[model samples]
Target: MQIVKYLKQYRIPFSGLAAGKHNFEFEIDDKFFDCYEHSLIKKGQLKADVEMQKQENMLIVNFHITGVIQLTCDVCLSEFESPLDFHERALVKFTDEDWNQDTEEVLVLSKTDYELDIAGLLYEYANVRVPYYSKCAEQGMNQSCDPEMLAKLSSEAADAEEDNTEEQIDPRWDILKNIKNN
Candidate 1:
């Protein structure tokens, strides 16, 4: 498929490499997110510095990711860019078993596998760096919510409160209140 071809660049062909440390660099941009159908990060400009240590039985990969992604403010819904920097490590082990075991920090690949596809790993690293609560003033560089939008929201709330106060009470309720007072 087209998706596979696009992601081929992220595959590291380790079959012929010397058993030692190797360094790789990748540029992650808006097009990178297009590969994922439901990615939380839609737009970003990032770079990934990867260090892979290959041993006889296993490979240890370290990811250093740095970039800025566009996020929406929770308060005013305004879009802003937030800087991201994080590091994560994954362990890949080779096995002959048909059923390979994998976890967040570890991966099991068949001994016959010649390449490691890192596109999925890179996607997870970037998404996990996103904060649970995103606010423009805090995450953005010296930025705040839209003042005009905030003012409009406040005025709408005040108008709704005023309308509630102007609603007439039922005559039946008034009689009940008078009886209680007496």
Candidate 2:
């Protein structure tokens, strides 16, 4: 697991600082995922970065990330890469005293005291950035899609759909089939 040594150095320098903005970056790799037992997200590399503005007592954070997760298709259940990208921001306030955090977006830390553990923040940012509905592209949508797989999947789906409609009104459907009789 690669820790952000740069940010840790910033914490040491925070003692010498007035208020200012800072930037941080990270390159996520397979070893990073292995640390969390997150084997499900394998094969794809990710990049994450953040900008934090420190103004007197308030901290405004902006995050940007991009990556891909190898996922199984919903229809054919075949493995495919799903691309992801994300952006978000949050406000943090330094308080003279500790206060219970009500929302995940906001953080309030004791002013007389310490620093933020951006490890968790970075992890959360990457996870939340991914879309919930990510799926493999359709037959012609993705040009390189396997032809044999697409044909089998399309035929199976069409068969199921036909069966469903047929089961819904097979008897009355026969009546409609003779529409020209009477």
Candidate 3:
């Protein structure tokens, strides 16, 4: 599909590189997230700096990703930008085996493969950095929840509590109370 072709820029062709350190860079934006169907991060402006060290049989890749991602505040339901800076390392091993084994930090590639597609790895790295509970006050710089929204929520809660107190009780409970008083 068109989406898959768009992400091909992340592939690194290491077959011809010498056994030394190599550097590559990529820009991540909203369109990058669109390639994924269910991406946690919808929008961001990030730069991925990759340093790959190629050896005789393996490659060690270090990723330095930095940028700001748009996140919705859980407390106030407002949109805000949260800065992201993270480092992750991945090991790619070349093997002749028929079966391919891959993990979060390790990858096994067939000897015949000439390029390593890193779009998925980059997506994973960016998504994992998001907090489980996102709040503007905590994640964003000098940011806080919306005062008007908080006030409206508190007022609605108070009104609900008042309505509950005005509800009529069963007459049997009152009879039981009177008997207990006696």
Residue pairs clashing in model 2 are none
Q: What is the C-alpha lDDT profile of model 3 across 45-148, one tens digit per residue?
A: 99999999999999999999999999999888999999999999999998898755588788999899999999999999999999999999999978999999
C-alpha TM-score for every candidate: 0.89, 0.63, 0.91
Task: Identify the leading candidate in terms of lDDT.
Answer: 3
Candidate achieving higher lDDT, 1 or 3: 3
**Candidate 1 C-alpha lDDT tens digits along 79-132:** 999999889999999999875558889999999999999999999999988889
What order do you get sorting by TM-score, best first? Answer: 3, 1, 2
By lDDT: ranked, best first: 3, 1, 2
Q: Is candidate 1 or candidate 2 better by lDDT?
A: 1
lDDT of each: 0.91, 0.64, 0.93
* Model 1 residue 132 distance off true place after TM-score fit, in angstroms: 2.0
- Give the root-mean-square deviation of each candidate in angstroms: 3.5, 7.2, 3.5
Error of 1 at 71 (Å): 0.5
Clashes of each: 0, 0, 0
